[model samples]
Structure formats: structure tokens, C-alpha cells
Target: MKPLDDQQQACRDWFEGLRTRICDEFEAIEREAGSGASFEFIPWERTDEDGTPGGGGVRGQMAGKIFEKVGVNVSTVGGRFSEEFAASIPGAEDDPSFFATGISLVAHMANPHVPAVHMNTRFLCTTKRWFGGGADLNPPIPYADDTADFHAAMRAACDAHDPEHYPRFSKWADDYFYIPHRKVHRGVGGIFYDHLDSEGEAWDANFAFTRDVGRAFLDIFPAIVRRRMAMPFTDADKARQLEWRGRYAEFNLVYDRGTLFGLKTGGNIDAILMSLPPVATWA
Candidate 1:
């Protein structure tokens, strides 16, 4: 594997550390639910087009009484983008070389009352460098209070850095996470941002904001999980959750950029697809 520069190494470390914290917190929730489940971490590698080693990462997964399925992945990968793909990526058209590090997570709860969630943050470098990611809540059975709490946490994270962030990124999420064909949204919107240039000395603030987003997610999500994980649900509720999961699956497989990026860059199939719920029903 190629040695990462200082910025790359620093971002990579944070992403990995966040993964550890999230996995531990999730395991604790499982224990509280009277399950002894822990995350099974599988390390995987990536190869560049020329067969050179690209950096890889751990895919941490767990199944428990509360969280039916969850995956938290951290990856630091560097390689040259394909010529066809280069033009679409910022700063990659001239030089297809790039590096990216981030954490991506998705949780599917066993109980319908508990909301499913997604959180991700990434730093990518080409001729330019930038940070991007966001968190969104997906509840099969929506609760006004839970949705308010989740958005409040995300807003706090965004407001801490810049007042403009919450409104801008929240709208971005609403636009980005929509299912055009279905004429509906995938979930309650959060925030989505990209091309947050990390050029020059802008790294510190941008990186700090990214860290804050992760921290906000860590702070809020587990609390929500605890609140609803033990709630009783009927077969009708289970059916609703499964049917909603089908929509989740369709979005990931079709419109999710991270999914396409992972596939195009030769990321581990299971890790890339882990965002898909374990069981989903159509029709």
C-alpha cells in the first residue's frame, strides 16, 4: 500500500476511531436488550486497476435483539479513477489519481418503532481535496418526536460550524435522497454536502466540522435506539417495516452515490452492499 500523506493519515485515523466507538456503543445496546451480540469485523483489501495494492478497511457488522442488522465500515483507499469516471469527479479530470477515507453506517432495527438510520463522512483528495457526508433517519413507523430529535442533533452539528450549513445541507439531503422513479423520499431528510474544498489551510475547519457530524450522530442515534428498541409491535408493524425496507434497498441499489463509488473502485461487495437491509419484501 502507498503511504498516506499527513492529511490523509489524520482523516483515516478519525474514521477508524469513529468506527470503533460506534461498534462498541451498538454492542452495549445489544447487551441491554439481553443479547450477547458483538460486531464481527472482517478486514478486506482493494486492488488498483494496475494490480497495485489500494488501502482497505474493516467491515464491522452485528445482529442482535435490538438491531436486527447493522454495518459500520471504515475505509482509506487510494488509486486512479477510471478514465470514464474521472470527468465526473471534481479535480480528477486532469489527474485521475485520488485518495478517500470515511466511515459509512446503516442500522435496521428489529422493532418497527425504532428508526433505521444512515450516517457517513468522507475526505477525498484528487487534484483537490474535500470533506463530505451526512446522516439521515429512516423509520418505518414515523414518530414526530423522534424525527425532531434526530434533526435537532444534525442541526446542532451544522450550526456549530456555520449557520448556513444546516439549511443548505438539509435541503441538499432532501434533494439527493429522493427516489425520482417512485416519486417519494427514502426517509426523513438530514444533511448532505459535497465538494467542501479542503484546499490550502482550510483542512482544520472542514475536518473539524466533519468530526462534529460524526459526534452528533454518535450522541443522538443510540439514545433513539434505546427509546424504541424494546417497544412491542404487531405482525402488521413487521410487515410495514419489511415493505419499507424494500424501498431502502431500491434506493441503495439505484441512486446511492456511495454504492456506485464502492462498486466502481472495487470495494468489498459485502461491505458496499451492507447498507441493504437483511430482509426486504416487495409488493
Candidate 2:
């Protein structure tokens, strides 16, 4: 595989910048709670099967009084996908080699009333190139107002580029973030989309949209966290949060494409599995 081109580097830089800002904001949140916690950064490298330099990434993680557990990571990697996985990825059917850059984040709140959230966006190139990712809310104890606010932010981000985005992507999230065996949704959906192929001007448009999605998340989620983080919680609420986290665990381990992709590409195991909650319970 060849080195990243100018456009690829631009995308990678944006993702890394987002990661830095997010980590800083999260650390501020911890400080406000009178907790001395802050993200511990760990750096790691990637190598292709033949031991060629593939890229690497930094993982930032923190467990604080209010935020419980959160991970924000940015990575740039390129190499040939495993033969079996190549058959499944778009554009990789003909050429298994691919380049990918993105930021991924998952936050699990200490207060059950405060929602757990996930957001990620990426630019990928194989025989073709595209952008894919979205954000969703997962509250153990559902609150109508919070759900509405989250959707509103996502909708505004979508509406900026194309009016059709919210409806299309929100429904896509409803379908994608589902647990088939349990016959239940993973959470209240925000937006989920993938394989947004970049054709001609589409690259610029899609890249702009992807950046807005990140901005929307950075804007709204902290507000939601602040609103609920100080609220009281009972034993029952904590129990529900644990049970809900089990479902989250199941979805990531069994169905998350990002997890599979990372593992297949020989990504850092700790960084890839950082999405899992710090603790969870089945019953």
C-alpha cells in the first residue's frame, strides 16, 4: 500500500485534533467534580502481517468520579485486510489493501441518569474511498428530554448539508444499533451510516458533514452530562445501569464492525476493546 495522500493526511489531522479537544474537555469535567483524574495517554504502533510499518495511534483513557470510564482514540492504519475479511469489506473484494483514519470515543457515566455515548467517524480508502461513522446515546435510565436534545443536535448537523440526512441516517441507526437475539435496540438512536463513498465533490461535502457530526457531539453531550451527573441515584438505578451495560458488552463483542475490523487489522487490543464498560452485570 502507498502512503497517505494530502487529503488523507488532512482527514487524519482533523480526527487527531478532535481527539485532543475532547480529552481536554473531559478532563475539565473531572476537575469540576473535584476529582483529580485525567486521561492517561498510551501510544502504540501497528505492523502488517509481513511486519511492514502500517501506522499507529494514541489511546486516551480516564476513569473519574463523574465520568466513570471513557476512552478517546485516534488512529491511522493501512495494510491488506485478512483474506476472509477482505471478502466482506466494500472495495476490498478486488483489492484487500486499505488505508483508514478516524477518531472513536465511548463514555460511560457514573450516574445512571447520565447517558453513555459513542461517536466515531473515519475516512477509508481501498480500491475506493469513503467516510463513515455517527453518534448515539445510551442511557440506562431513559429521559425523554435528554433523548430529544440529543436527536436535535444530530438533526441540526445533518440538516446543514442535506435535509434528507437526519431521517435517513437516524433510521439507519435504529436498524444498525440493534441486538437481534434480544430483539431490542441498543439504545435511543441518533444516527448510524457507513460506506458513504466519496465521488468527486462528495469528498469535500462528506468531510464537512463528518466534522459537523463531531462538533455536534462535542456541543451537546457535555451539557447532558452536566445536567445529570449531579443528580442523585439509588441502588436500583445502579443495578439497571449494570444490566444495561451487559447488553452493551454483548453488542460490541458479537456485532460491532469496528471491533472486528480493528482485530482483523492487528490493532492494539487494549485500544480496540476500550469501548467496553469498566464494569457490567448480566443479572
Candidate 3:
């Protein structure tokens, strides 16, 4: 309703800053693997349905020897939601206006041995405001140690905020990232959370928790990538990855809330769809 508050502006800035840090780290990983691949950031504008100008974002993408394809995006957009969508978003039943800012990332590893990954964190306002997002590891060739370490990092991030956070959010991820038709869970679940209301003084604590999640992803995922990046894989391994990718694609296109939000808000098409893998096989 009023001009963006100090806290709201801070959230937007933080998301943008996180995007830069992540892109830099990923590029460094590319270099370590003897690939010169670097992210190319493309900027786009958002326009509201009634022709008012909304904020925009940059989409960062790279393909390299280790990472087959990766996309990192930071977006800050505000405008009215459509009547159909407004009813579903909390606090938007009466006022269709909304504000959202966050960072989202998805990486598809070139080597099948190196697991693919996804992570995101966001803050949204619609009369009511809240924070949400998470990370997960998806490996075609599952490694027990890799899964354990990934979950441990996420649990540490959660435990720092609240003792109940790890168990609650971890289960939330398992439930949220499921493929009903195939009766399979998507990846080795990490953490998924949403609708964490930031009321009054509670905003600071919630924001801090969200930041820790991002920090955990930054610190842990690259370590995992480097661990298996050099491992050799056979033709069968590659085939399994391709098949798994098809399932990943299905979830993003059909069940992902972020994808729907971006499309509804006039966000960049390529950036919104960046979660989809570069290549996949149905069978």
C-alpha cells in the first residue's frame, strides 16, 4: 500500500546480493574443473496487466564441463495479482496487490556422478508478508554419503533457527517434492518451507533463518560437486541421468508454485523456465 518499507527494500537488496555471490562461486567451480565457462546475465523488465511498470531482475546462466546447465535468478516485482490467483495467495483475498523478491537456483551436472541441485529463498507481501524457500539434491546415482552431508548442512541451518525447524521442514520437503503419478519423491529431499509470517519484530528472525539457508547451500553444494566431478561414468550412467531429468522437468512444469507465479506476473519467460534441464529423455 505505502512505498516499499525499509525492511522490504532490504529483502530485495539481499536477494540481489546473494545472486551475485552465488554466480561468482559457481564460475570459480567451472574454472577449477578446467572449464572457462562463465555465467551470462540477462536483464528483463516486468509490466503489470494494466500497463504500469513493475520491477525486474537478472537471469544468470552457465554451462560447463562440470555443470551441464545452471540458472540463478533474482527478481523483485510488485503488482496486482489476477482475480483467480489472488484468491489463492494468502492475504490477497481482498487486495490483489503483491510484492515478491527472492533468489532461485538450479544446477544440472554434466557428470552423472555429480548430483544436480536446486535452492531458493523468497519474501512476499500481500497485505500479509512472509518468507519461504529451500534446497534439495537430485542424483541419478545416489550416494549415501552425499545425501547425508547435504541433509546435515540443511539440518544445521534449521537447528540454528529453531529445534523444530529441521524435522518440520524436512518432512515438508518430502511431501512437497513428490511426483504423484510415478509414486516417487523428487530427489533426495533437502528442506522446503513456506508461509513463514514475519509479523512485527518477528521479521528479523525469519529473515535471518532464510539467510542461513542460502549460506548453507553456498557452503555445501560446491563441496559436493567437486567431490564427484572428476569421477568417470559409463553410457548407462548418462542414460539414467537423462531419464531422471525428464521427471525433474515434469515437476517444475506442473507442480512448482514459483513457475506459476513468474508466468502470472509477466516475468521473463526464459528466466521463469530456467529450472528445466538442458536435455532430458522421456524413457
Cα lDDT for residue 253, model 1?
Answer: 97
Error of 1 at 263 (Å): 0.6
How high is each candidate's TM-score? 0.99, 0.98, 0.98
Per-residue lDDT of candidate 2, residues 1-283 (tens digit): 3677988999999999999889889999899999999999999999999889999999999999988999999999999998899999989998899999999999999999999999999999988999999999999999999999999999999999999999999999999999998999999999988999897899999999999999999999999998898999899999999999999999999999999999999999999999999999986
lDDT (0 to 1) per candidate:
0.94, 0.95, 0.93
Could you tally the backbone clashes for each prediction?
Answer: 0, 0, 0
Error of 3 at 189 (Å): 0.2
Residue-level lDDT tens digits of model 3 in 1-283: 2367898899988888888888899899999988899999999888888888888889999999888899999988899999998999999999999999999999999999999999999999999999999999999899999999999999999999899999999999999999998899889999999999999989999999999999999999989998999999999999999999999999999999989989987899999999999999995
lDDT tens digits, residue span 66-90, model 1 = 9999999999898999999999999
- lDDT: worst 10-residue window of model 1: 1-10
lDDT of 2 at 276: 100
Choose the strongest candidate by lDDT. 2
TM-score-wise, the better of 1 and 3 is: 1
RMSD of each: 0.7, 0.8, 1.1
What RMSD does model 2 have? 0.8
